[model samples]
Target: MSEENKQIAQELIDAVGGLENISSVAHCATRLRIMVKDKEKIDQNRAEDIDKVKGAYYNAGQYQVIFGTGTVNRIYEQFIALGAPESTKSEQKEETKKQGNKFQQIIRTFGDIFVPIIPVLVATGLFMGLRGLVTQEEILALFGTSPDALSDNFMLYTQVLTDTAFAFLPALVAWSAFRVFGGSPVIGIVLGLMLVNPELPNAYAVGEGEADPLMFLGFIPVVGYQGSVLPAFIAGFLGAKLEKWLRQRVAESLDLILTPFLTLLIMITGALLVIGPIFSAVEAAIMAGTTFVLQLPFGLSGLLVGGLHQVIVITGVHHIFNLFEIQLLADDGMNPFNALITAGIAAQGGAALAVALKTRSKKLKALAFPSSISAFLGITEPAIFGVNLRYIKPFAMALIGGAAGGFFAALFNLEASGMAITVIPGSLLYVYDFVPLMLYVITNVIALGTAFVLTWMFGFSDKMLEEVKTE
Candidate 1:
């Protein structure tokens, strides 16, 4: 740790109370989550008073301190230096261990891992989804006559910005996972790109067949690492741990030479042999589980669809589900679950739109409007956090409303024939398959209308709604 960082960390620890008072310390994307045995053991107000500290919150049995951007490592080192005992000293472990059930743990872990990245994920994902909307028809029209239309510059830029992420999702996840695990995000990104490189054909399975190949250590096969979660996460987690350990152990004299070499050796080997397979298995398990749930009685499916849809959005793993929708659409030429999620996304938007129209705060309104539009396009965090979560009531109302929509869609067995950006008229691509097209349209329209009415009724108050237009 830098002397300056060490100083800051030490001072903050001292201010909070000696390391002995700290029951546990952990971190998420941008904050130091600390738990002290006693509320009075250390001065909470004093910790918050520090210049480097952004803010603090005591909730769900955790004391969270927001810190400077990218300061987690420094803070972590300082906590260690303060001679705080490891997990053995933690008082809350018993309570934390009892957190409901496996489903809840999965939900909690998913939230812990992905919530911090939602803003960026949604921004980039939305932009890509929108870009597709802008270029799809033109590309299709051009392709209708000439195959070369896709080669145009306008199409190329859009393709690069939007399709590139899917094409290189493994790399994006690697970086995001690295950030999550306290590693150099740049290194994680480079490692991710290597996994997906087309020239490295054998390196990973390119969506389609490729001629050239890249071998890992000249042997183990690297497969689709893009947009994958488990492999990158496993690799990045090991890499970060290795890096931290090496940086601490290597002598200053030979550190430069030994550190990078050992780190790379550990990461590459660990990723190729372990992380990759683990993630693949996880992917398989999830698909199996979802398939099982979908096959259940319609009410059960509706419940899972409604509840898990939001959970999926929260975890940023909905893209994997979206991929399933796309494949199902292509194979069966229709997908009912997709309709369920569409309703869920619409519910998010309805709730946010309600809050936007009812909130008195100008800043909140400004924040809510764009988010609501984004949710309409199928990105929901800005709506979820900025609006729905704040009002609290709206999210639950939306969820129940979403369940109602899902029940109706499932009862009708409405399926989208193809996936399209939600904002585009092209989202109507599968509407023709609707039995009694008018009923299908009305059903979907009612889904959104019901959500809106529910949110308005459940979320709006005379005072809040009246204060809304003040600005």
Candidate 2:
């Protein structure tokens, strides 16, 4: 392979004493990480010299080569073609569970389970925002009609758009959790449906006292788990474990019929009767904890969370927010986390823009400009590791700007119609209401402008340009 990407991969293999030295390999958003048979066999200096390789380091028993966003995936494709072990970031994450502490493993599992489901939530948020705008009294006045003038079918369509995801959310969560935890996804889906079955009293209506709950075994109150997150996730996990256990002992002659039959019967019974009650309490505690943080006095919640959100990104565990945001929405009917996080994300783009504008180095200019564009579009990995973090002061300046924006968001009591996105795309969540839309615009302006002015003024200087120029 004479192509540039292939050459990079070939050289990387050579630097690590050829492909034979590689035990396994994987990559994350920005780096290609490899475990080798002998650290002594690797030529670290030579590896760093390769094109598109921004830097190199050894950490946590893996030799990490920083290739920066899109470049890493291309180089990894070449690496795999050259006879290295085939792997993915998800598999890399799975390996981490074996090596990390319990809390870390749990976070990884949460990421694995929820990452696939976030897009649906984001789309639901967008539809909710659109439906809100279309249904508004002021908006309908332009059309010479009112919400009361709308037909029942039109209203039902709006409910389908905004409410279906949350309505069947438990099934989605259980299916994903079951897949992640190694069980039949179909079974998880069925169990989840049972949680929200029409045969049972609706959870929301029961909470509102419009319907009485079904009493199980004389004392336990039972209702549908509509919109619940943790209960479904835990049920899926325990069910997957039981299925695996059953598979090991069930005879080959009757494995198919007995294992699935027995597994479903026991899991559904246990979930409704015993397991569901336990996680319902756990879910409430989690909701309370996030609520406490969101309501911290005087915008302290926004300041702390926004300022530190990117810091958490650096550790690669930020997907943990998915669990919290969904729970917050289920409980509060609005998502303040969406408003709180966008400010920080906007600051990241701002910092990168400042660096791109101020830097004389062509290489730094090349990296910072596109990275800034991506950060604005709600993907900050490139902007972060490629530009701002490379210049320490820009990142710190951005944090201050984020804190400033977050303070205003909380103080204004701003809430979004959605989550799972931020910055430019995140603007969708605020469009339903004029006042909150203005507040959202102001939040980004403050964040972007603050970081821009700070970084252009003092965060960057001509001195740092020399290293970037040479590299």
- Cα lDDT tens digits, model 1, 184-292, are 7777777777666555444223444654333566765456455555566567667767777888999999887897678777776677666775666776687567567
Candidate 1 backbone clash number: 8
The true-versus-predicted C-alpha distance at residue 375 of model 1, in Å, is 8.9
Instruction: Tell me, by TM-score, which candidate is best.
Output: 2
Best candidate according to lDDT: 2
lDDT of 2 by residue, 121-194 (tens): 88988988888889899999999999899999998998898888888898999999889989999988998998
Model 1 spans with C-alpha error above 4 angstroms = 1-155, 202-221, 291-303, 307-398, 408-444, 451-471
Cα misplacement distance, residue 67 of candidate 2 (Å):
5.4
Candidate 2: C-alpha RMSD after superposition: 3.1
| Per-candidate clash tally | 8, 0
